[model samples]
Target chain A: MPIGDAPPLVRPIVGRANRPAITSHRGRARWERLAPYLLIAPAVLVIVLFRLWPLLLGVNFSFTGDGDRNGTPVGLDNYTDLWNDPVFRIALRNVGLLVLLLPVAVAIPGLLATFIFLRVPGNRLYRTVYFFPAVLSPVIIGSIFNLLLAYDGPLNELLQTAGLGSVDWLGDPKVAIFTVVGVHIWATFGMALVVFLAGFATLDTTLLDAARSDGASLPQVIWHVIVPGLSRTIQFVFVTTMIGMLTSMFGLLYVMTSGGPGGSTYLPEYYIWIQQGQMNRPALASAASTVLFLVMLVVGLAQIGLLRKAGRED
Target chain B: MRELRVTKWVAAVPMMAIALATIYPLIFTLNVALKTRHEYILDRFSLTESLRWDNLGAAWTSGGISRYFINSLIVVGFAVALLLLFGSMAGFALSHLRFRGSRTLFLACLAALFIPFQVIMVPLARTMADTGLMDTYPGLILAYVAQFLPFTIYLMASYYNGIPAEIVDAARIDGNGPFGVYRRIMVPLGAPALLSVGILDALFCWNDVLIALLMMPSAQHRTLMIGVTSLRGQYSSDIPTFSAGVLIAAVPVLAVYLFFQRQIAEAVTAGSMKG
Candidate 1:
C-alpha cells in the first residue's frame, strides 16, 4: 500500500506517541527537531562550502593580486587589467553577439516543438534524431563539426561542387564565432524543442480547436493559441537557452577555435579558462569570473523582466 | 485536431528535412571513422568502400582514449552515485520534512543554480588545491558533485512533491522514522525521478569538459572528452583515427539516448517546468 509515503502537508505529529519519561520525551523532541536538518545537512554543507562559498571567495579573491603581487591587496588592478586586454574585449563583444542571436535560438526550438506536437509525418523518428545531438558532448559535436567544417572539409567540398567559392569556416575570425554558435544551436535546439513539447502537453486543446474552427492559418494558430498558452514555458526556454549559450560553449570553443585565429571566439567562459589555466593569472581570472557572474545575473534578470512583459502582453 | 492533419503533413516535410540534417553529422562522422586515411583524403563525403574496424582499436589503445575512458567511468560512476544519494536525501527532507531554515536552504540551493562553473572556477581551483585534493580522481569527483548536486536535489524534490502526504503519515503510523519513510516509501515511489535525474546527472558528468579540465590538469587524468580534444593535436593528419576516437566517446551517450530518450526529455522539462 506504500502507506509510509506522504506529501508535505501532513501536520507535524506533536507528542502523538505518548512517552511517560521526561528524558525520553526530551530526546524524542530533540530528534524530531533535528531530523530534517540531519537529512539536509550534507546537501546544504556541500552547497554552502562549494557553490556559494566559491562565489563569495571568487569575488573577494578578485581584488587580490596574482603571482609576484601574491597575497597583497591590489584592488581594481585585476579589473583594470581585464578592461585593458584585447582578448577580453573580444570576449565581451562575442557575448553581445550571443545576446543578439538568442531569439533565433529560441524560435528554432519553439517551431520544431510545434511540429512535433502536431504529430508531423514521421514525428516519432524526427524527435529521436533531433534530440540525439543534445545528448552528445560538445567535444564530440565540435570534433564532428571540425571535420565537416574544415576548410577543405565536406561542407566546403559540397559548396565547391555547387560552384561556390570555398569558405574558411573556422580559420576566419569573423566567421568562427557564428560557426561555433551555429553548432551550439544545432546541438541544443532539440532540448528546447522537447521542453516546448512538454509545455504543449499542458496546453488547452480547446483553444486550438476554436482557433482552427475560425479558419485560422498555421501562423495565426501558433500565435493566437500556442504562444499565449505556453508563455511560462517560452520564458523558461528563453532564460535557459541564453544561459546554455553563455556557459556551455567552452568545449566547442576549446576544441573548434581555442579563441581563434584572431581571438574572435573568446567568450567570457573561455577567457576565464585561458586566464586561470593557461595564462597563470588566477587573480585576474577571479576578476573575470566576477564579471561573468555579473553579466549572467544582468542578462538573466533582464531576460525575466522582458519575458514577463512579453508573456503578459501575449 | 482532426482538421489539423493536412497541415501537419505539410509541416512534417520540412521537419523531416531538419531531422535528417540533425542525424547527418554523426552519420557523417561514423562514415568518416570507417574510412582509411587515403579514402578520406580522396573524398570526405563518399561512403567508405571497406569496413575498417581497426581504427576503433587503434584509437582505443595507442591513441590513449581507453585510459581516459576508464578514468571517466570511475569518476562519473562515483560522482553520480553520490549525487543521487545526497540529492534524494536532501530532496526528501526539503520537500516533505519542513524545518528551521528549510526555505532558506532551498533558496540557497536555487541561488547556486544561477552560478555557472566558470564563475567559480578560479576560487574553486584554489580551494581544491589548498586542500591538496587537486589533480586526483576524488578531487574531480567531488568537484562534479558540488557542481551538479543542486540541480539533482531540485529535480528530486519536485518529483517527491508529487507523492501524496497520506503515504508518509501512514508509514509513521506503522512506526517508521523519517529515514525509514525515506527508504521504504520515498525511494521506491521516486524511482522514476531517480532514473530520470540519474541519467541526466550521468550525461552532465560524462559530457563535462570544463570542470574536468580545470580540476584534473594532468594528461593521465584526462576524461574522454579531453581525450577527444587532445586527439585533434595528436592525430591532426589522421582524420579517420580521430573520428574513431570521437565515435568511441559518443557511443555510450548514443546508447543511453536510444534506451532512455523519454526519461532525458522528461528530466529536461521537469527542470523547465519548475524554473
Candidate 2:
C-alpha cells in the first residue's frame, strides 16, 4: 500500500513537470498556424492606421472649430460656412459640369474598344497607339495639351491656317472647363480602352456569330449582343470614370490653369488642396474632404443600386 | 462578299482614326522634345530637322533626373515587393485557412477598395508628420503599400480562389506544412497574377504624384513626375527642355507597358470581366 501511494504521487509530479513541455508544443503549433496572419498583419495595420484612421480623424475634425493646425474645437460652422461660400458653390457647379461632360469622355473609349474588338486589320497597332497616352503621366499630358491649346500654340495656329477663328482655350471661362474635360479624356482614354478591350474579349463569339447568321446588322449585333455582354464592364468603367473625374482631375487643373482666370475651372479637389496646403485652413480642408467623401459614397451607392437593378432586369 | 468588304472598310476607318489620335500626341511630344527652342517656337507641330540627343542628355544630367529616377525605383521597388509578399500571404490565408473571422477580414479588405486617396490625404499627411515619417523614402513606401495593398490582395485572393484546392491538400498529405504549401505550391501556381499585379503596381507607383508631393517634399527625393512638374516652373520659357523632361519621365512606364502588353491585356480583361 505504501509503494502504491508513493508511485501515484510521483506520477502526478512527473506529469505536472511534463505539462509545460506539452503546453509549449501546443504553443509552437499555434504560432506556426498563426504565422500567415502575422505576415499579413502589417499590411492590415498599415491600412487601418494610415487610411481608415485618418479618414475617421478627418471626419471628426470637420465638425470642430479646428480651423487650422492648432485650434480649439468648434461646432458645425464649417459646413454652414461652405454652404454660404460662393467659391464652394462654384466648385460644386464645376463638379456638376464634370459629371455632364464625363459621358462624352467615357463613350469615346467604349466605341474605340468596340471597334478594336472587331479585330479589324491593325488591331494590335490600334491597341498600342491607344494605350500610349495612359503610359504618359498626367502632368505630361497637361503640359503637352497646354502648349497645344495656348493662345499661340499649334492648335490655334492650325485653326488660323484653316481660316477658323483662334479662340483662347484656357482663358475663356465658358470654355475653360470644356478644354480641361477634353484633355482629361485624351489623357485617360488609354486605360479605359484597355479595360474595354478586355471586356470585349470575354464577349461570347458564338452568340455574335449566331446573331450575324440571323441577319443582324453590325449595329444591331453591337446593340443587342455585344452591349449586353459588356454591361458589367460598362458599370466598372462608369464608376471608375466618375471617381476619376471627381478625384484625379486635380492633376490637370493644377498643371493647366491653377484654377485661374477667375477660378472658373476650380474643382473641389483643387479647392481642398489650396485650403490645406496653401491657406493653412486645415479645418476647412477637413470639411471639404468630408463633403467629398459623402458625395463619393452617395454616388458609389447609387451606381451599385443602378447596376444591381440592371443586373436583375437582365 | 460585297457586304462583308463594306463592313470591314467601315470598321477600319474609325479604328484608324482612333489609333492616329492616340499615337499623334506621343509622336508630337517626341518631335517637340527633339526640336531646338527656335524650331519649337517657329513651328510647334512640325517635325525636327535634326535629332537632338543632347536634349535628352541635358534632361538626364542637369535636370536632376538621375536622382529622381533612383528615387522612383526605390519607392516602386519596395512598394511592389511589400505588396506582393503581404498581399499574396493574405490571399492564401483567406482562401485556404478555415479559421474564425476570416470572412470578416476579407470583407474589411474589400471595403477598402472604394475609399479614394483624396478622402484620406490630409489626415494621412498629418499622421506621417506625427510619426516623423515625412520626407523619408520609407515613409513614402509605407504609404504606397497601404494605399495599393487592398486591390492587390483582392486580385490575388480571387486568383488564388480559382486555383484548384487539390494541390494544397495533396501537399498537406505529402507532409508539407501550410507555409510550405504556400511557398512550394501556391506561389508558383499563382505566378500569372503576381506578374500582372507587379507590373500594374509598378506603373502606379511610378506615375503617382500626390503621395510623393506630400510625403517627400524635398527636391533631393522628389520623383520623376514631381521633378517634371518642377521643371515647368523653372523652365517656363524653355518649352523644349520642359518637353524633354516630360518625355524622359514617360519612357520607363511606356517601355514596361509595351513589353508586358499581352499579360496586362489578359489581366485587365480577366479582372474586369470576373469582378
Candidate 3:
C-alpha cells in the first residue's frame, strides 16, 4: 500500500526515521507558516505589477490627453474623440458584425464535433487535421491567406478559371472584414471543436443511444437531444468564440489587412494598437482600451445571462 | 451512433472536403516555398518539379527570420521556465497548504485571467517604460509571464488538488518541511501538469505577436510572428521567399503540435472546463 493510504499510527514511525530534518519545532513551524507566501510571491508579484495594476492605470490614463496635454486630465475627452472618429465607428460596426457572425462561428465547430462524435468516417484523422491550425500563430495564417487571397492569388486564379469574376478580397473595404473574419473562424474553429469534443466526452452517451434507438432523424437528434445536453458547452463556445473574435484577430488584421482599404477591418484591439503604436496617442489608445474592456464585459455578462435563460427554457 | 451508416458516409464527403480545405493552405505554402519564383509565377498551384531548397535557405539566411527565431527562442524559453516554476509553486501552496488570503489570491489570479492583453497593453507599456525595462528581453518575458501566469496557476492548482492530501501529510510527518515536500514530492508528482501547462504556456508565448510588438519595439528584437508580419512587406513581390519565411516560423509550432497534440488538447479543455 502507498504511504498516503497508510494508517495514522505509521506516521510516527516515519517521523522518527527523519527526526534530524526538523531540529527545532519553533523554526519549523515558522518556516511552515511562511512557505505558501514565499512560493506564491513571484506569481503574485508579477501579476499585480504587470497585469492587475496596469488595468487600473490604463483606465486612469484614459482620462488624460496625449502630446501637449500629456499629464493633464481631459475628463472623458479621449472617449468623445473615440466616439467621433469614423475609424473607431467602423471598428464598433465591425464588432457588431462579429456579434452577428458569432452563431455561425460556434455552429461550425458544434456540428463538426457532433459528426465526429457520431463516428463519421476518418473521425480521428479529421480531429487531428482540424486542430492543427489552432496551434499555429495567426501571423502565419494571415500571411498564407494573404498569398491565397491576393488579387492575382490562387483563389482568384481558381475563380477565373471557373469563369467567375474574381473578387478583390482584401483590397475591398466591404469584403475585407468578412474575409478576415472568415479566416479567423477557419483558424480557430478547431479550438472550439476540441472543446466541443471534450463536452461530448462528458455527455451521457445513453441519451444518444436512446435517440438512435427511437430512430430519430439526424437534424431532430441534433436539435432536441444534443443541443439540450450540450447547452453549457454551447454557451461556453459562444462566449469564447465572441471573445476570440474581439481580441485574438489582431495578428490577422495586422498582417492581412492592417485595418486597411479605409480601415474597414478595424477591431478594437487593432484600433488600440494603431493609436498607441502608430499614431503616438497613448491616452486615446487607453480610452479605446477602456471601451473595449467595457464592450467585452457587457458582452460576456450578457451572454451568460442570456444563455442561462435559454438553458432554463430548454 | 453507428446506426446512421448511410448518413455517416454522406457526411464524410463534406467532412473530407473541409479537411482538405483545412490542410490545403499549409500544403500550398510548402509547395510554393519549394518552388522557384519563375515556377511560382507560371503555376502557383502546381507541384514543385524539384524539391528546391533555395528559398528556404534565402529566407533563413537573409530574411531576418533567423534573428527573430533566436529572439523568440530565448524569450519563450525563459518565460515558460519561469511560468512553470512560479505556477507550480503557487499551485501547490494554494491547493495543499492552509494559509491566509489563499482564497483571495486564487480569485485574484482568476480575475487577472480575464483581463485581455489589449485591455492592459497601454498602461503596461507605460509601466515598462517607467521602469526602464521597455524594448528589452526581460520586459517581454515578464509581460508573457503576467499574461499567462493565472491560467498556469489555475491549471496547476486543479491538477494538484487531485493528488491525495494523505501524501502531503505523510511527507510532513516524515519530518520534511514545506520546501522539502515541494522539492522532493510536489515537483515530481506535478510533472505531468507542469508539462501540459508548460507546453500550453510556451505556445502562448511563442505565438504571441501583440505583446512582443509592444514590449520589444526595436528592429532586431522582433519575435518570429513579428518577423512573419514583416516578411510580407519585405518580400511583397517574392511570394516563394515569403512563404518560405512563413514555413520557417511555422515549423517549430508544427513540430510541437505533432508531438504534444494530446497534451495541448488536454490543457486547452482543462482550461475551458474550469473557466
| Among all candidates shown, the one with the greatest DockQ | 1
lDDT score, residue B174, model 3? 77
When candidate 1 is compared with the true two-chain complex, its DockQ is 0.60
Residues forming the 10-long window of minimal summed lDDT in candidate 2 chain B? B266-275
**Distance from true location, Cα of B240 in model 3, Å:** 0.9
How many residue pairs collide in each prediction?
9, 1, 0
lDDT of each: 0.90, 0.80, 0.90
* lDDT (10s digit) by residue, model 1, range B1-275: 55577888888888878888999999998998999999999988788998799999999999999999999999999999999999999999888886767787888889888899999988889899999989999999999999999999999999999988888888977767788889999999999999999999999999999999989889999999998999889999999999999999999999999999989999998988875
Give the docking tier of candidate 3: medium
Please state the interface RMSD for every predicted structure, separated by commas: 5.0, 10.8, 5.4
**Which residue runs does candidate 2 get wrong by more than 4 Å?**
A1-28, A67-71, A307-314, B1-5
Clashing pairs in 2: A65-A74
Query: Lowest lDDT 10-mer window, candidate 3 chain A?
Result: A1-10
The TM-score-based order of candidates, best leading, equals 3, 1, 2
Displacement of the residue B144 alpha carbon in candidate 1, Å:
0.5
How far is B5's C-alpha from truth in model 3 (Å)?
1.8
| Of candidates 2 and 1, the better by lDDT | 1
Per-residue lDDT tens digits for candidate 3, residues A211-305, read: 88999989999999999988888888998898899999999998898999898999999999999999999999999999999999999999999
Candidates 1 and 3 compared: the better one by DockQ is 1
